[model samples]
Target: STEALSLLEASGYDYTNIELGKEWFLLGGEESVTRVALSKEVESGATSLPKIFVGGQCIGGCSELASLIDNGELDALMKKAGATKKGEPKKNTGFLSFLNL
Candidate 1:
């Protein structure tokens, strides 16, 4: 669980509002949009752990996040997750750029 959270934080997630599951699995409220999206992924049988979702879509887990970051797609997802409004300029955080939210 410690490691799971560390990975989430390192990926720039704000872990405060999210509740951890019984075994420290990341969880959202029963009605959470992300939870629904992640559930779809699980139901579809994706063999990944630590699922990630944003803007009502399952973006995927740690490996997927790294790939998206490397490919520059993560910025858009961050924005969609309310990191910034459509007309807002991206915040300038030195090392952890996307964590500005």
Candidate 2:
């Protein structure tokens, strides 16, 4: 989880970290079997630790995040999600900018 957090920090986009307790489940209501089913929904059939979600969609764990960074897609994803780098002001674009608000 620390490694994942490091990668995200280097990416410069703000992120939220939710450290689930050992007893917490990702999608399962309260049963282990349902947890297995949740993993299946992602087609991995196994949940990876330190899962990352962007724009409310799961993008897999640390390795996946690394891959996105390596391939330069992470920036695009963050931009699309309207995420700005920490300490940077968001640029108003399109209709909002035209309105001059």
Candidate 3:
């Protein structure tokens, strides 16, 4: 879970972290309600720990997150969610940069 959090932080996207306690396992509690809600949203139908959701959509676990980062899709998703990079904007060095693409 820590690895997942680290990856997300490194992505430079604004995010909120919610940690659930043992009480979350107890039925009928607020945490449990949240868990249930997450389960419904999760595609696997199992609420796994360290699940990452972007724009109210599940993006899977740490492995999935790492994959997105490797393939450069995370930036697109973050932009779609209205999150800009934390620091200076990325410079475009490709040929399309001349067109401000």
- Point to the candidate with the largest TM-score: 3
- Model 2 lDDT tens row, 1-101: 77888888788776666655544443444365534544664546556566676765567778888999999998888777777777878652220000000
Please report, in order, the local distance difference test score of every candidate based on alpha carbons: 0.49, 0.62, 0.65
Which stretches in model 2 have alpha-carbon errors above 4 Å? Answer: 25-45, 90-101
Q: Model 2: which ten-residue window has the lowest total lDDT?
A: 92-101
Q: Which candidate ranks first by lDDT, i.e. highest?
A: 3
Error of 1 at 89 (Å): 13
Least accurate 10 contiguous residues by lDDT in model 1 = 92-101
Stretches off by above 4 angstroms in model 1 are: 1-4, 11-38, 41-43, 84-101
* Candidate 3 TM-score versus the reference: 0.72
Clashing pairs in 2: none
Which of 2 and 3 is the better model by TM-score?
A: 3
Tens-digit lDDT track of model 3 for 22-64: 6555654344776687678778876666777776677777888
TM-scores for the candidates: 0.46, 0.68, 0.72
Worst 10 residues of 3 by lDDT: 92-101
Q: How far is candidate 1 from the true structure (C-alpha RMSD, Å)?
A: 8.4
Q: For model 1, how does the per-residue alpha-carbon lDDT over 1-101 read when each residue is reduced to its tens digit?
A: 34444555565544332443443235445555544544565546453356555544555566666788679886777765665433446452221221110
Ranking by lDDT: 3, 2, 1
